[model samples]
Target: MLLQLCLLYVTIWLHSVSAQSSSIAKPGCLERCGTQPVPYPFGVGPGCSMERSFEINCNTSFNPPRAFLSILGGEIMGINPTNVRVNMPNLALSTYGQGARILTVVYGLSTTRYTFSDQNWLTAIGCDDMAAVTGLANRSFSGGCVSYCQSAGDSGGVASCPNDSNGFGLGTGCCRTPIPKGTTNLFVNLTDVHRNWRNNKLFSTSYAFVGEMVTSNFSYRLNDLNNATIFLSDNWSAKNTPPVVLDWKIGQQNCDEARRNLTTYACKANSECVNFDTNIVGYLCNCSKGYQGNPYLDPGCQDSDECADNPCDPNADCTNIPGSFICKCRKSYGGDGMKGGSGCTKLPPSTIINVSIDIDYTWASGKTEISSPSDTRPFISDIV
Candidate 1:
C-alpha cells in the first residue's frame, strides 16, 4: 500500500510538472505549499526544489496546513502555515539583563563559506556597561555603546531618569557592535564591567541576544525572559546558489575541470557541472528549468503542472497544456471560463449575428484588453 501510494504521488507530481512548465512566472521560483511562502531558489514543485539539504515537506492535514523545512538529514525545525504570520522565538535574557548571552544554533553552511576568512565574533551593548560575545573558541570581537545623562531629572516621570532616557533599540536607548565573520557556536560574557551598574536596579535590566546589538527599549521587561519573543537576525548566505552574495564557495567547479574525469564527479545529463570556487575541490549539478529529479541520475528535472492540484476556480475547466493549463469555458458554455456558463444556450440566430457584427475589431480588442488584461479579471463585464 505504501509503495502504491508513493507511485501514485510520483505520477501525479510528473503530470503537475508537465502542465505548469509554460506558465511558470519565475523559472526557478519557489512556491508556498502551506502557510509558508517558500522563498526564491527553494521551491515546492518538482525540479524547482533545492538540494536535499533544503527540501521541505508541506503537511496539509492541519486546519490551515503547515510546511516543515528539513535540515540535518530530515530533522524538523518547525511548521510554517500559509498566509500565517511567523514570529521567530526571541533570545531571552537573565541576570537582570546585565549579562551577555549567546545562542548556539546551526546555520546551514560549511566552514569555508565566510569571505573574510575570519569567523564572526560577539558584540556587546549597554549604558556604562560593556559585554563581549564570542563564537567557537578563539574567534572574537568587542565594542560597546555609552549612555550619558546629568543630574537625574524629575521631568521624565518617575525617579528612574537614566533608564527611561534610552528609547527602544533605535540606538539612543542602548548600544551595539558588530561580530566578526565566519564565527559559529557563540558564547557571551561581560568584560571591562562595572559592578556598581550591575548592582543598581536601572542597569540591572541589561539584556542581550546573538544577532541584535542591544536590548535597549522600555527597560528590559523582566517578563521577556519567560517569553520567547526576541530573536537575533543573523546574516547567512549559501554560495553557488540563487540570490548571489559574497561568501565562501562550497560545491563549485569549472565544467572543464569536472568533465575531464567523471568517475568522482556526479553531474548528470542536462545539468551544468561546476567546481567549488573557494576550495578548488568537489563539484555540483544544477538542472535547467522545466525539469527536476535526481540530477545525478539518467533522468533530470521533470516538468510540473499546477492545474492538476485544482488550484483554479472550481466552476472552470482545466485543460492541461505542455507546461501549464488553460482555464476555459466547459463544453456547451457561453460565459467566461471562470464560472460555468449556462451551458450552451441557443441564442436567436438574428441576435447572434447582430452581436457578432456589433463587435468592432478595434473596439472589441480594446474592450477585452481593458477589461481582462490577463484574462483573469473576475466576471463583471456583460458578455452579450
Candidate 2:
C-alpha cells in the first residue's frame, strides 16, 4: 500500500508537469506571488522549462506555493523555484539547560548557465557577543563582515569596538561588508566571545540574515542573537534571478579529430562548427547571425524579428531588415538620426533661411530682416 501511494504521488507529479508545459503562452505571464515577480529565462508552467534543472512547482495552496528552491533533501525558503537563492543559516551553540548560542549557515551553487552578482553586502549583528560572516567565490578570499557588542545599554546605539556601544560590527550594533561577483558558495559563523552574553539571559535570542544591502536594518538586542524569527525579513523581496551563462561544445573529440567524423559532427543547416578552447579538439555549433533559439534541433535557429518589439528610440523610425534592424529620422527633418554613435545634428539656420524665398539673404546674414516676394499682390491675392 505504501509503495502504491508513492507511485500515485509520482504519477500526479508527472501529470502536473505535463499540464504546466502545455499551458505556456507566447510572452507568457511573469511568475509572481505576493510582491515578488519572477524574472525571465524562467517560467512557472511545465513546458516553459528549458531543462529539468529549471523546473519549479507553483503551489497554489499557500497563496502562491511559498517560493522555494529545492535541493537534495532539505529546501531553502524564499528562493523562487525558477530563480535560485542560497541560504546560509548561522551556526548555533548551546549549553544543556542554558539554551542555544552561535548559529552558522552556508549556501552553495553549482556552475551552470547562471552567473552571480559580482558583489553582495554582508551584514552582521551581535550583543556583547562575538560574530563573524565570511564568503568564498572563484577559489579566492571574497570577503566577510563582523559584529560585536559588550554592554546591555549599548545594545540599542551605534556599535564600535573596544567600547560599550550599541553597535557591534563597524562600531555599530550592525556592520556590513561587500563581496565580489561569481561567488559559487558562502559560509557564515556566529560565536559568543565574552561569555558575558550569558549574563543578559536573553542574549542567545540574537540572530542575522543576509539580503539586498539596502533592504535590511538591524536592531541591537541581547535576545536577538538566538531568536530564529528575528532574522527573517517580512518585507524582503527575493526577485534577483542571476543569469546562468553556459559554454556548450559539440562532440566528444577534439576539433581536428571531430572533423573526421563529419557525418555525426552535428552541425546543421545555417550553423557553423567551431573548435572548443578547453580542448582544441572538440567543436561546437553556433547559429549564424540573425538566428536564435536552440541550434541542435531541426528547424533550429529561428529568425529573430528585431522590429516586432520596437527596439528603436522613442522618437525615431524603425526599419526591419533580414535578421537586423535599422533606425532613421522621422519625416520633416533632414538628419541621419540613429541612436548610439554620432546622432543627427540640427541643420544650420543659414540653410533654412536660404531655402525660404520670403527672406532676404543680404539682411538675414548679419541682422534680423524681413522681405516679401515680388510675385505677391496683396489685395488681389487676399481676395482670391
The candidate that achieves the highest TM-score relative to the unseen native structure: 2
Clashes of each: 45, 52
Task: Provide TM-scores for the models.
Answer: 0.38, 0.49
Count of clashing pairs, candidate 1: 45
Query: What shift in Å separates residue 194 of candidate 2 from its native position after superposition?
Result: 2.0
lDDT of 2 by residue, 22-53 (tens): 33222455455343444332345565444434
In Å, residue 153's CA in model 2 sits off its true spot by 2.4
Q: Per-residue lDDT for 276 in model 2?
A: 50
All candidates' lDDT scores?
Answer: 0.39, 0.46
lDDT of 1 by residue, 1-384 (tens): 999999999999988766554222235444566556564233454555435434455667865655554332221223221111121222323344534443223332344322222212222333344444444423344443443212122124221112222221333223444444444344454433445445433333333433312223223322222233232223211110011011232234566666777774555555665553333344446655434554544444444464656644555677766545566554444444443344333334343332212222244445533332334533444343
